[model samples]
Target: MTNFVTKESLFELQSITNPVLAPNEQEALFIRTQMNEKENNYNAHLFHIELASGHLTQWTFGNERISSPAWSPNGKLVAFLVKRGEKQQLYLLNSRGGEAQELTTLPNGVNSFLWSPCGEKIWLTTSVKEGLAITDEEEKEDKKFPKAYVVDKMKYKADSLGLLPQNRHAQIAVVELSSKEVTAYTDAPYSHSLQGISHDGKTLVVAVNRVDNTDDVFRTPLYLVDVDTKEEIMLIEEDGYYGDAAFSFDDRYIAFGGSDQTFKNATHGHVYIYDTQSKNRQKLTEMFDVPVGDYAVGDTQQAASAPTVMWTENNDLYFQVSTEGDVRLYYATLEGAIYPASPENEHVYGYAIFKNGNRALMTVSNPTFPGELFDFDITTGERKQLTTFNAEFLANTTLSTPEAIVYPTKDGFTVHGWIMKPANYIAGEKYPLIVEVHGGPHTLYANTFFHEMQLLAAQGYGVLYVNPRGSHGYSQSFVDAVRGDYGGGDYEDIMAGLDYALANYDWIDEARLGLTGGSYGGFMTNWAVGHTTRFKAAVTQRSISNWISFNGVSDIGYYFTEWQMLADMNNVEKLWHHSPLKYAANVETPLLILHSERDFRCPIEQAEQLYITLKRMGKEVAFVRFPESDHNLSRTGIPSLRVERLAQITGWFIKYL
Candidate 1:
């Protein structure tokens, strides 16, 4: 182990996520994940923690992929999803102690699971394909014959899932824990996800979008279904995203997260409360400026699932909010009053709010730390670190903590960013600067642990990353500003951020500058090198070069282009006008293109086109292609490949800068 961060530091990192607070309030269960270098894979296990003494205990072992752990109401038994076979199946274990028993045998793997209030049964979401066999034992012939995949739906393909199976829909199932028998509930053509259930277990809320065209965004309609009578009631009639739902303990209120698409993808998800008896819904947090949940983008976490929008025992709803550069816990009442419950300037990626609502078990991380569990007293705003999973990483690494920076954009708006000096920094020594941009255009760069940024800093470079216009964690207008102006103001904001950093800090080398980003950030990196020669070198990862071809090739291109550009193929002129390929000839910086072979978000063809075009022009460009990786190659791809990706980026910058 070395003091400075290296490729090996990624393997030493451990992430604790998906916290399930036990019913007794004295203990909690969470998934602890670590990158195992020996096997070159990720290993996940169920871990239990005593809240009072902060004693953590591992419940499961091996290289198993465990997820969605739910504790029974009595805290006597715990259930989770694990994949010991072809698909993930439900498994139950005693909370006190016991081997987990496999509980479900379904045609498709379970997507999500939730324990009913009574704990008599477990409701789950699993795929149901018409022509598929009922068990994994019956699918041997399909592997041998390999039938052709039918593509009749416009939304058939996705980034990670690839082309979806034909006639397959996410349906519901229930496992009778005592008898170990599973029952197929209502079969739906569309997806029917189990969101939350009432205390009485007589009703369940499910996430389902019964729309004609799947291309439309924010058309989700949650349904409150009667479990016994099979009756359905539409929770929200408006076309919006109301997926994350939870029923109050008394069944008096149902709270959910949604937005009416008033600002398209930029709209902040608001919290809503539906009165079960009155049949009236109240929109809370309507004036809240930030979105709900942890939208911070980073690679140091694994299996980090968002907590369902839930209610406290006092009927106050609690949720996480992405604001500025942090994700903090916040609770809102049915009266619409909201208040922060956790500390500021950290990423609360996962947490379990206690029934009393005054305490919580949070997985917190900062720039220097991977995620770890902490017992947080919400009312008192006190927190005690409960896990030392990354103790080795903490002791061995000399990481550079980011200094928050704010500067005015070309326009009137002020931009937020950070500057991390080199790990071995001297007061007067000028170092090379690398301006890193985040993708999503809708996602913001939070003040959480970023492995690549740390790697760059450790390599003797000042890493400056910014949340330019169109990045979330800001105002809706700021995020929507770059919708049609890809390279217009957004690009200017990035440059202005660079200019501010250089002007304000004397330790940064003015001439030796590098640029980098992925996805939208990758597109920007390409755009920056093409439009200006300010940077001596640049690296573009999982980028978009030509929007025209991207409109058809990318998994989400068809609707995404229209969503981001506000136009389609009919506006080829506009697409080309904003594409980085249009200005590739002007590129003078030696650029390194890194793309995943199986990436469907931007697709590998985009990188191929750029690399080929740059090679044809005899430009100083090199392309590194990673196999079996999608758009998340840098984050959750193969561990060896992730290491290689870091090496390529740092090596390129070291060579040119």
Candidate 2:
């Protein structure tokens, strides 16, 4: 009998995002994305969900996708981004809903946009063209540039479109809605673009990263621009990479999140607040240490760097903090008062503050639930479930809640982990155990809901996940312990965690152990199999095997490998010594390599290298590649493919373990 999970069952529920409360606070405008299995694409449209009537209306229509809907201060109009082919232009529509009028027709497209206080104009950041001059003599002299030498010296490289002309830098632009006039605000040789506009509309901030490379952390700077004259002043110098700056309502201060510099095994994110007039900046939450395991599960390279900050009407600034190995919401007063909101929630992904200041809408999930919308009241400190995406389906399915476990590492560090007992588990029956590792080698896997883990538990197998060394959510030193010792301390941490489970959990069968992970987790999975024969089966996704080849192929290859491994291609011998591929001959477990064809993050080549090497060594291995998918196949890919990927993973383990 074929046990298959279909797209309909996976995405029958709607996913909502970017919830903006109407000025009246009676309704909210949000983006509802539904999967179109026939087209194998997502259909995203604007929606207005009413609080009283429970009525929902589709606000935007047509083939183009509309997102990032921001309600005008006057509540008369809505400004959002509309995608037409490769171009993403800003458009305005009446709140009552009608035809959208195009506001700006930019060359490359807008990354982010915000409406001015008066709503007469919209400020946005877009990629702009910069011409290059080439000298015939210089072109002929250089072997690398035999033809016409074209120079585009910009801070950031333009994201490529199929055949469209590329622009290296992004600049801030202002578009007057009534006049339909567009003006370039700050156009620099190196790309500088706007990030957020203050409530007063006097100050505009932009995040400008290094143009030619991806080591943005070291080169990106946040600059302040005058909205009227477009004169730009460097607020945060082009130093360590930083982005996501949100201004307080009074424009008295600014809060931004990022790191000071990229270091080996360094994955901590710092949130800083600056006084506009005093120009004084203080880093907040330095006391709350971030664990390396948390970074391993979180989006370490990009998402972790781009933290969201918002100011409440009460003068308290709210931001996201991934402390204690869990991502949660926290609020800080302008006077340096800090407190956590909803600290009890296991995992809260996305959130939006309501206009009325009474409540906020958040996307919350735990070990059992997938993702559900919740209404959280600020004044009452109460949370109410608003929407259940898969309640009905889940009621009929057997799911197990993951139990949080604390285990001692070999080095005397107490590691945290979660274990899911098999569904309908018999009291004395032993079950196979799956050790799932998270990516980022810096992210965290908390006691939160994971559909894949639930599905494995539903299949009568125990699933175990731990915060090993190099993972985040512990102390900074503990997080940095795995740096330069990738396969050493981190390997010991996982083994120690596993040993704890084997010794404590009676239902876990040690002989039937399996392993799986993606990206950095994939790398660890590969590393784990090479180091031990305890795992009966293994599945690695978007993993890195050979650090030398990875250093040159991946988009983040140069910096990530250099920083994490504490070496570059010049240290080829050291890179190879630490790589899992070096010990491919020791593998006895049947392994499956899953990757995306267009995954620029880890690159599919990483999987191919491991597959070929394992097969050559007479080991059982299979390679699965997803077409047209990026590194975020599980979280952001087509619903159909995501379900299939999970099913394939389950099948692989069942067949072998």
Candidate 3:
């Protein structure tokens, strides 16, 4: 017997990330992040394990967050990032036994870094603002004065990064370990991210948007720069999109992820290998149907990096792919033979291969489990559970396992999704159902643990979540279907999925149906209520209601509006027609609108518009505003507030459904 998972289970969950194999191949280092309920914050620290003995140990202690822990070439030292100052600074620790010491002292701090092949120097990626010094200068307290932010570019602000500092770019810098001297590498007035450092550390591959006025477009190409000469050469010609580059041990070939933008952002990503000598590239997974990276979306998984191509001594490259609501590890040979590397039925969010060539450490998670580290044998398919971060919680909580299902849509499309019954489900008892739609319209709801969904299940509500036409883990045509159509076919796909569930599952009460989602899903929830009277209640989180206003107010409004809606200020008629606000008068279902005050992605204004319209018409509608939260409030918001937010949702459904 197990206890029902409550909203407070948020603190019980712990996530593991960035597992790197030690040089000796007998140990692995990783970052473990968990919540501190009393402080309503989170604490992250470095942790390592002796792979052979399965002994776990924590390296750092504090009420602070830690990330990106890496081992030196000889495994005698460790370097990690922490925010002890105004910005995150690099910290180094000696494996020979010494307290961690702060390494780089940049005023703007570091974005990311790569360990040199010889471990003698480290490559630093940092943010640089023009008309400013790189070194820390004595701060002269400025006289209190009012200032106004001014911008001439379309990319003036981002969702999480907030307003972009004028003339600032992500640039590359180098640090000499012996001298502790820092050298600025690229100063092209464009953002540059260190992709791969050559085996000899003489050549570096960096991804940057060097084109003029790229603020209106999204594109980054890789370029090779000589360490000493500062000579740069473009790696890909006619680049649509490419990155995640890594050089082979012999520097013979470079493997990376690329997309020709066949369908723009909806294009399927593929793996490619470029010959350093020939300067020619080969599309290794050109025939693969899915995207090249882990496109799986979940609330529990945090800071999972974009998919990358990892090269081994052999002609093999390892990568992860999202397919049919599952993210798994797959490897492809130079000859283009792709096969599964890790186990099936679980999400491998992170992995590190040992130099010994026989084993790998995998960070795996699924619906029943929060996440943990696992030791996997590549050749024999043998595996061992390495970490039990969520074992006690698992044993204590009665979590619901989702049952996968596929139903036919009105347009002859097969929609894939999962149905989770209540945790304390009773046989032959009818339960109110809540239809969960995912955001992104591009990202996927895969086989991963989600605290919010489990909370709904534990509250005795059957949950239905499906990947409609606009979701990832499907074909390019499927993912691209929602483009320019908005509430058209994608809306039909969701309603049809719900109808199929009602017809197949007698345990779900049709009369007491409810609907909810965030971001894109929130938009769908708003659309569903306005168009149909089937749902008795609905909750929209950080959602969009008016496309016309969203296209101008959102952070990505400048380009994303045209890319998805295929309409800009020039076509206000089309934008308004697709907006859920246009159908607000027809809404009969009681609605709850949840939004973040600081959300620039969808903007809180969207929620305000819908709330005002419904309230003016004397309709059953309510709005809840989350303070000090962005678009990610549900996942990475204040721990106490996250619980309160869930209480609002379950409470709303309980009152109406």
Candidate 4:
């Protein structure tokens, strides 16, 4: 029986992420996540694989969901994080086999941890009180009394963490493995993130956002602390959100990744090397055009942090880059030589490279595959698939492969996109087409498998997804081009791509065009319908409609509007000019507004305002509000809700398009 992807098929899909290469390079550890259909929950377990023997072992069990596995330098023990009771804690187990032992019992719980180079100690991050704070019991009593929270800090509240703790700030601490002794390096009024330790274990690097008024500028400075003296020195003084620092094997140089906030959140990250001997810094990837990350946004898997700089024996850097919708590995030398180390059309979500750099363990996926660990030999350019967690499920499923496309936009610049025809596609058969725009306007729609696209194709719809001018993985000018211009260039790029597809591909039905997107893509969808009537129907998820209300509503709206649009309340005219709601009177297409109630990035109100206006005008529009969901509802929200959201999207297009 040949079964195609569906909303229910999401339950059968498994994701292999966070591949960690052991120090010996003989084995690898990774997280294999699967959805529990009956429970409607996700369960992640630690899995180990021998690179040479191809043998796999499930190391954890009982649905405790583990992540961030770190192997000791000696390769004898593995440390992983898991939520126990109410807090995330660290546990360690011997490689030979044994029950994991609780390592740390910090009051604030562990946020992130890294093993020291010598393997004798561990550096961890935890939030602690910054000032004289009331006890938890007292705080609860105060809440019972209904006292108002006096607002002081301009940048107080956040999305995921909810209301910011009045007194707590993330601090760094080091724990000795042998004696179980803990030492606090930072306390009070400052939050610190442990980057990495030096080879000799004498210095530990940390990143701190010490700006007095964070609302003014985005700045994260790097600091090197002497382990023995407990003295900190600001290294990498000129920076914007710099971290992920790693010392070379010989401790000659420290390499890290960051950007100068040229475009704020839309800025491309670059890798740099700081010479400890000469006390000077040099940019190794100044010429590399692509951003150093797997910045392609997707709902199927958790967004993996960008791979940090990995050092080779000869001081070459093995890092990841988002280029043309694929997150591939690239090797860069100090002398300005850079080239791809991974093969084409494969997305390396996360990777761990050995000090020798000749071998690496990475989680690789593509349009036809979910994801799996691969033992890669950099010098020989070979890869051996190490895990088959989803082989059985995928073997029974029919998938669609996308065709790479390059179409000219109206402005003379080129746009890159991918098109997936209906399953069992036939020549000269006109099929309904669905155009997908990605979020992050800065994020890429990459060569990775997307569940929604596959599901739509299963229903006999051709899906067209593209990286417009605002998307990453392109030239800086191309990404920044969307900023300030907003609907001008990016809108034309999308419309031009659609025009090219309809003109070039005979299998696409020009009369049955549909549009759907989430976040920034949602914004574009709203803009598309108001500007053009080509799309018969459009589905917008977590979209922004009215910039006037969005600036005050969204968590990042105030700064994001100013940074991305170059407009604020002061420039209401420009803001309104770019707002889709400003042109709501022109909309005629049936619109499906999907949003989460708790989406702080693109709040549900954005949907409400658009939905209400369309309804008042007697236009065709429907709104669906997901309960207890956040901005990441599509990606990491409730399993049942995710299925429902997909069903609604597929149903909307099927009923209209």
Candidate 5:
């Protein structure tokens, strides 16, 4: 007998990421991430899938975590990153057999690395202080007697990496595989990212901002350094953010994905090719309306970073595009013609192209299951399931399939959304509806397996999620429309989607409607309840309550508020005009505020402000805080805490809705 998906069953699911085809093309290497329910954390290890035999092999063991597995060009060794003490360093393991060996022990550790074409050396990026090379002992001593942080730069704190070192910047380095000797290439004050080495391994490319006194993080230029001489040459000097670069097979052109920041953060990322000889750049994705990266947000697992561009030997550029909530692979020719490289209705999170250009190893997820590896035949359009990581769990579990719907707003503008039916549906029975908003007012709710939505469906509630105007899967104008006017059209888009569902679906209980969202979605939930009493209950997570305080508190609030809301602390009236806290007394729905204690993006103080204001106003509100959690608590936080969060959301709706 099949069973409905339960929170406990979350441990049964596995995550597959970073699929890279072996140089021989007979197998592929990927990281398998699994949750240890007993320990309440996640463990990831390296694994390889055999193409012809359909066999899976675990290349690493123990409880230690590892990631970013790269196969050497010569197919002799596989190098990956493993954490030791305070830093993550590179480790090498023989392809045939033997235990892995540590390659380098840099001070701050390696962030990312790439194997050279000859497999004789590995290029990497590591952080270092501008003039001070602090040793391990000094690093330990500083922790014993902590000093005050001297503030200098505008970009001090990041969401994931936390507080940045005063003068530390990421620099490029190379390690000779044979001698195990490391050499620093460039020493600069600005942070640099290691893109890749040329085909002949003589020239290296790194993305950085050498332009003076510019605080914009989105605008970066590409720089090429002679591997032996260490001489740096600027390639393209356009005022745009550029990374995910790859040199053409013949070393003539370099393809990268970026946006010119026309609309700031909401701009669509396009594919651009730079001619090495002429230093001229041409846009390759001018006609492709969708953004050139994965923007589908979910709570099922930790998201994987996909390459911005994958190049074939023939200079065929393949990349992923987020469109209408689903991520699809596309290949483009030099002349600007583009076509789909993967099937429809499937989210291709990450992919690695085989040298033959006809096959690719992809990490694919659909409505039915979590991510898994599959061998895709580009020519024949044949896909073979390479790994069955979630086969057992999926076989015993029953899930609801979402029905895609395209509806119009009050202004007749079309919007895309999905409605997931209750797991055990009947003909005439009415079911309660839950409207879920995604966090990135710029993100999408797509055709992927969302664990929270599935769990809600299992509990007899219909789940509805939509992509508003500011989402990335649409045109450039649509995404930019939500920048200055947050609560106007974007709010109507969500309400119109709910209206369409209630009008079209007779089995929905309009009186028992509930709303929930995180980040931007959380902000929307707060705005919706204050603006209207239609929703009976609501849950807001990691949300913003006051734009005034948000500008001062959030890590990205200073610039993000100016960019998204078109207002800063200087504009007090405009900032408070969009703040949900300003209208707290108007809230009629029972609201549940969930927030992470350490979330710097939308700090927990935002939740506190909302809870106290609603309580002072004698409104129905409750606050729940998770300690040591950040903005990503729902997705990559502590495993046990994630499960409890799902329970809290489910229980709140069950009691009120």
Candidate 6:
């Protein structure tokens, strides 16, 4: 059969995510997202793929968006959240396949929900009533506060469910499976818990961020509550954000990750094991490295959000470590003993540790291959390749293999990067170079198989990507070097890598240089053009132009900006001095700005500001806005739109370079 490639074909490729192995370990259930080009919406369905037979079947069907498939302990029934009309309601389905039964008639909507260990109850976090104010007249008349107007956080920024104010915080609710009754648990009118529940059903841990009118952003503290007695205890309190706590199998200690902010600078995260009985917290890992390459983790030198922590049957702690340019699994004991289970390989993105503990099911990818699941034996370090998701597609395509390179920055610090040569290239032929900047200023670029880099290489462009000062996988000091000096040494590190490529590789065309990046990478691209005219063309996606404006606009703008730059919005002059928009007059390179209209993390206004400025100055500039995309447009948006985005970006480079 001839392979058909089209705009529709781009949308036809379905994505499988959040794979959870069933209790029997014979089947895996995950969320499969299908993109409908006609509607420009993604339809997510729950699917169960048989491990032994390679049989794939869809379990959920309908117009509703179904996600977060959680199997019960018995593996007979699965619980998931479905968006019906305007509200997201909880539903239960038979593991085999059948019509799902609705569990909640919540008026507002459920944000997140999980099942109890014994499958006796369901815990959910949701926003119920609109909002209420403490009024003097209503308090005196009926001893009840008057209802206030509902403020939806998702309205202004189309991509996010905005941060609800103190008056409209989300509350936790527990629904007993037998009684079919729901009870509110710790409904604070002024604060909201980030995460809920322990491994055992006895205690509930919450990350509470107190809201006040003042600009002072208080830290998120971990609070423990006894399920039966309803007694809440403060477990861990520090001067930073903390959440994503995983309980040990015996429930003796709780492992959590947190970062500290001193002055305006934020430190990398440190994993801590908290003893519930003694009320003591011990630091587990001091510097857990963030993986380079994949942007799954946000820009942080420390471990990714929700540090992958699991307790083995042998009382050993198993977690993923992404230090040293590759992602690897590491085993640690409560007594601070740590070792790698499979330290031989350089790349391991996704993993699942079974309750059986003899083997670990994982999805491994390398520089040439996309991703394939494998069953790795813990005893012998043997691996068996399982599913070949895109084997045929890969066989038909000409993929590029990245070579890792290191070069010294002007400041004497060595920076790491991966370079991809043009596919089927002639020995002496020179090719145009594309400098791909990764998104997280804190994220690293590793030697993993990247579709975009391979596509660019197929198009006859040599792709060069580098992990600058702020990138992870490096030491904490190197990652922190980019903080408060965004465009300084990071720029030098990128330039040094480019210089190394030009000096070492004779087949690189320096005159035809092109640059592109999203998020922080986009910010650096915008900054790059303003500082130098080295690149012939550039594309900046979801970029930040004005730090001063970004501080007030973004979801984590207030705290993140302060944490990154060590400066608040009050330092407007300092922020603008570092902003790319301030140097727009010196920008000579042709630029293309791509932005998601609903992006709350970076906000579309940042893109608009740069586009309008460059166009008004009579420079070659174009702006493309994705209507319903979030900050994760490339990763999780409409499939066709993602292809179009790539086409537009490459097209811009083709036209200029």
Clash count in backbone of candidate 3: 0
Encode model 1's per-residue lDDT on 305-367: one tens digit a residue.
Answer: 876577788988789898888888898888878888877778999888888888888899988
- What are the clashing pairs of model 1? none
lDDT (C-alpha) at residue 164 in model 1:
69
Name the 10 consecutive residues with the lowest summed lDDT in model 5.
132-141
- Per-residue alpha-carbon lDDT of candidate 3 for residues 1-657, written as tens digits (9 for 90 to 100): 788988888888888888888878888888888888877788888897998899998999988778888888888889888976358988899876679988888878888999988898788888877655556453453569646787777777788768877677788887887787888877778889988888887888888877767775557877888888978888875447887678887898988887876676777888888898897888888888888788777878666553387777775778888888888888778887899787656788998776544677888889888888889899998999989888899988888999999988777778999999998899999999999999988988888888888999999999999999988878877999899998999999988888889999999999999999999999999998989999999999999999999987999876778888988989999999999999999999999999989998999999999999999999999999998889999888888888889999999999998
Worst 10 residues of 2 by lDDT: 154-163
- Give the C-alpha miss distance for residue 249 in model 4, angstroms: 0.2
Candidate 2 vs 4: which has more lDDT: 4
- Candidate 2 residue runs with Cα over 4 Å from true position: 1-8, 52-55, 61-64, 131-167, 209-217, 262-265, 291-307, 354-358
Greater-lDDT candidate between 2 and 6: 6
Could you tell me how far off, in angstroms, the CA of residue 408 lies in candidate 1 after the best superposition?
1.2
Candidate 1, residue 202: CA error in Å?
Answer: 0.6
Segments in model 4 whose C-alpha atoms lie over 4 Å from true places: 84-86, 131-143, 178-181
Q: Each model's TM-score, in the order given?
A: 0.97, 0.88, 0.97, 0.96, 0.97, 0.87
Report the C-alpha lDDT of model 2 over 222-305, residue by residue, as the tens digit.
778776786767767635656677887778878877665645436577777888889888776565565211232421111212
The local lDDT score (0 to 100) that residue 406 gets in candidate 4 is: 96
Pairs in steric clash, model 4:
none
Q: List residue ranges in candidate 5 displaced over 4 A.
A: 84-86, 133-137, 142-144, 211-217
- lDDT score, candidate 2: 0.72
TM-score of candidate 5 relative to the true fold: 0.97
Give the range where candidate 1 is weakest over 10 consecutive residues by summed lDDT. Answer: 132-141
lDDT of each: 0.86, 0.72, 0.85, 0.85, 0.86, 0.73
Clashing pairs in 6: 153-162, 293-444, 293-445, 293-446
Error of 2 at 447 (Å): 3.8
